[model samples]
Target: MNINIDIDFGNLWEALSAIGTIGAVIVSLWLARKDGKKKFQVVLKTTIGMRNDNSIDETPYLSIDAVNKSNIPLTIEEVGFINKRDGKKVTVTNQNFLIDGSNRLPTKTESYSLAMFVFNQEQLFKELQKKWPQGKKIRAYVRDSSGKHHFSKHYKI
Candidate 1:
């Protein structure tokens, strides 16, 4: 058997174009994922901190220091902390968050940033010293204007 047929170049071109479009979308998704992963790494590294300075008296009053590295005044939308007491962890937060300043400026501000919990205050530290007389570890975190959080170079409790 012998068969001969003329190919429609217009149809062939359209098929190739569809394939090209699909390939482009796949590439775009891959690039976006890679970028997203890189961003997570940056934030993670800048967030977690080491407990090198273990001074018990280093007042752990939660506060925030905002630096406007971006070319505009960035506003922090939230700040919170997680603390452990009696083998249980608790979270404290302030939703009415705001960091105000101009571009290329750093704002050093502190308000009612302390935890009102009786256990998290300094009085508890004194009690711990009298009872356990051992070091207690509490992790603190601060969220910035961009919602990136960094922990303290840990202190003692």
Candidate 2:
């Protein structure tokens, strides 16, 4: 006895097209998911204010604000100022510099007054007032819970 197998060209073409369409859909979905993860991000802002301690003179202070727009929490490791001209990092060793925030910054929330520095106020004021050397910037070094470091754009003052 002999068995004959029939090959249908039209059916084969239709099956191939279906497989291609399925593959394309899978690839599109994967790309969408990968891009979605990048939507989670953190933003930082800095400003200067005056603080007086029962004195006639007012002292300038630096305030940093951190906003978490991502779905996960972030940890702010260090905060300081950067002299844009010579690219120098400045940090006060005194107790006036305070870091106030949870180790884990929650998602989709703003942390106000996260850090404040009262030291070197006069020097900072002089830098801001001076025309030479351009301007100064605030820098905050942060990391995620997974220990992935994230940097914010330099906020010029």
Candidate 3:
């Protein structure tokens, strides 16, 4: 006995095309999610300002502003100022400089400020001005609850 079968080429092509389309959609979605994770970030800004005191006169300070611009919350590990030329870092950690030592930073809509007192404002400003052209930077080191580290862009102060 002999068996005979017929294969429809057009239907096979259509099925293959549908499978390819589905696969492409799955890959695209996966890539999109991965890129979305990269978009979750924190931004840091630094400024020098003067605060007046009634009896002690005016004091100048450096203010560090950290903003969570991502969809997820972040735990700030360290905040610092770096002298690019000498590789010297002045960090808030292990020091009493930070006005608020709290570590948690809320998601996208929240911001935190850390203040460091400048003993001599004019001297500090002069040094910063010279170093600013040489790549002085403010750095914020942060991590997610999952312990994944995220570094903010090097902000030129």
Candidate 4:
């Protein structure tokens, strides 16, 4: 008895074409995802010691820093905190800690650079306490010029 084998070159070519198309689609998708993602980070710092710039400021203050970790520059629009309990937002626009006159909002930050906003800690605490008594947890946030918000970890006030 003899066995017979059949080779279908047409079907083999069609299968190879389908595989190539699938691979091309996958590579395109991967590249698109990698290029479309944006990176942004925020850091919150608090200082209780006296600050001396022009005159000695004995009041404590809170600093919210917006850091540009991406390769591109980003603009910082505002920096403030949110009440964790009631979800209330507070925007700090006055009483900055910088004496060099460079601490302004809507500032541009270069790659690996940081833009910071400072506010009187006691003033902010009193304002927050008026709405949320007995203290509450708050998280710092920075809003970009594009209206995107970046947040930091929670801190008790």
**Highest lDDT: which candidate?**
4
lDDT of each: 0.39, 0.46, 0.48, 0.73
Task: Provide the TM-score for each candidate, comma-separated.
Answer: 0.29, 0.41, 0.44, 0.68
* Prediction 1 TM-score vs. true: 0.29
lDDT per residue (tens digit) for residues 5-87 in model 3: 98766777898999999999999999878655622254454434433453533444444444554444444445545654566
| 3 versus 4: better lDDT goes to | 4
**Predicted model with the maximum TM-score:** 4
Question: What's the C-alpha lDDT at position 24 in model 1?
Answer: 100
Question: What digit string (tens of lDDT, one per residue) describes model 1 on residues 65-154?
Answer: 333333234334333333435543333332222112211212222331221111224543454355443466554444444566544343
Ranking by lDDT: 4, 3, 2, 1
Could you tell me how far off, in angstroms, the CA of residue 22 lies in candidate 1 after the best superposition? 29
Clashing pairs in 3: none
Worst 10 residues of 4 by lDDT: 94-103
Clashing pairs in 1: none
User: In model 3, which range of ten residues has the least summed lDDT?
Assistant: 110-119
Better of 2 and 3 by lDDT: 3
lDDT, residue 141, model 1: 47
Regions of model 4 farther than 4 Å from truth? 1-36, 48-58, 95-102
